[model samples]
Target: MLSIVPRHYFLGFIPLAAGAELITVFGVVNKASGIYGLLSIFTGHPITAAQLVLNIISLILLPVFLYALHSVRRQQALPVVAFSYVYFLDMLANLAFTIYFSVTWFRVFDATATAEAGKGTASSLDTASERGLSITIIVLALLFKVYFCFVLFGYARMLVRKAGLRSDNGEGKYMKQLQFIMLAIAPSFWRRGGRRAGKGRMVNTLEEGIEMY
Candidate 1:
């Protein structure tokens, strides 16, 4: 029999792939607009556009991160489990942020654009519709991410339990017993002791009777 890749893995990959494309495509396509828009987010001043390219490239790593994360099949120890959890969180947060930014970038318009276009117009309604669709995509991506997060948690815990239940690869060796200064403390030794005590008392009583005579 042949084994097949499960459906859930495919489902999980889709969102991550979508996010990777969204960020890198825009960041590169609008390179002239300056990737440095992100600098304003960080130090309150925009840096060179060259710096932004790195940020855009970083977003492309999300799918790779997701693939790497999904590849962690087992945790050999408790700390591995913890690491897996943190890894999953980082990946999820990265992907979610990308999805959020993509939605705003493609579906939303600025106040100036909206005001100039005027309300009740076809463009405004189209923007609103696109925003709604983007929101739906975001929600679906979130749900998929949340599901996989729980799956990783459960798998990590299972790995921990399996690790705990595992038998150690211990070596069994025998050595000469140490000769104790004390007598052997086995039950047979105690039984012999009781009999010897009775015999000693009998001998003492006989000696006493002979003296009394």
Candidate 2:
């Protein structure tokens, strides 16, 4: 049976993620002036440099993402698990850098002062509605990424266990910790507790089990 959800659609963000980073890398490189631009040499940010490296790393992983999407779409455990693992780690690093960027941007008073001054005293910097909308969008994006990562982890676990790949009957330490992190981020992961009843029994974050056939 065909899966109801376009599980492959989750992978659609791959290019956007890569493109955004590529843009940022050049922004930091050329020292362009704007929100897209990173810090200037006079007031450099270590995190901006870190973001450049990670963005390059992400670009290099584009093939891994493609393989993951293909594997997941075909229900192939080997490549799905392999690339999913890599992508999840990449995503964790990405999230950390995102937080770092937000913090660093907040502290960049020179740019903030310049931007505020350009407003010509007509409006305050605090625009509550604009700030609220931005925060909502960011929070939603983060939540979706976390949930999808968890789904990948769970699907891989189900496959490995079903195939009887491990005699020890345990998930790996890294995957376990990653799943735990996801669970902590999303409390609605109640269905995973019932996996003993069946294999591929999804407790949906998106599917609430939507990815399963």
Compose the digit string of candidate 1's lDDT tens values, residues 72-141.
4223333334444554655565576666576466644556457657754547667678668877887787
- Residue lDDT tens for model 2, 1-213: 112212322345543223323322332333222323233333664445676665556556655555455565565554555654565686687688778776675467446655776976424445445456666887787776665565565565455445543322336887655445433432222233334433433333445546564
In terms of TM-score, how similar is model 2 to the real structure?
0.50
Q: Residue 204 lDDT in model 1?
A: 100
TM-scores for all predictions? 0.39, 0.50
TM-score of 1: 0.39
Whole-model alpha-carbon lDDT for candidate 1? 0.45
Question: How high is the lDDT of residue 210 in model 2?
Answer: 60
> What lDDT does candidate 2 reach at residue 57?
65
True-structure RMSD, every candidate? 21.9, 11.6
lDDT of each: 0.45, 0.50
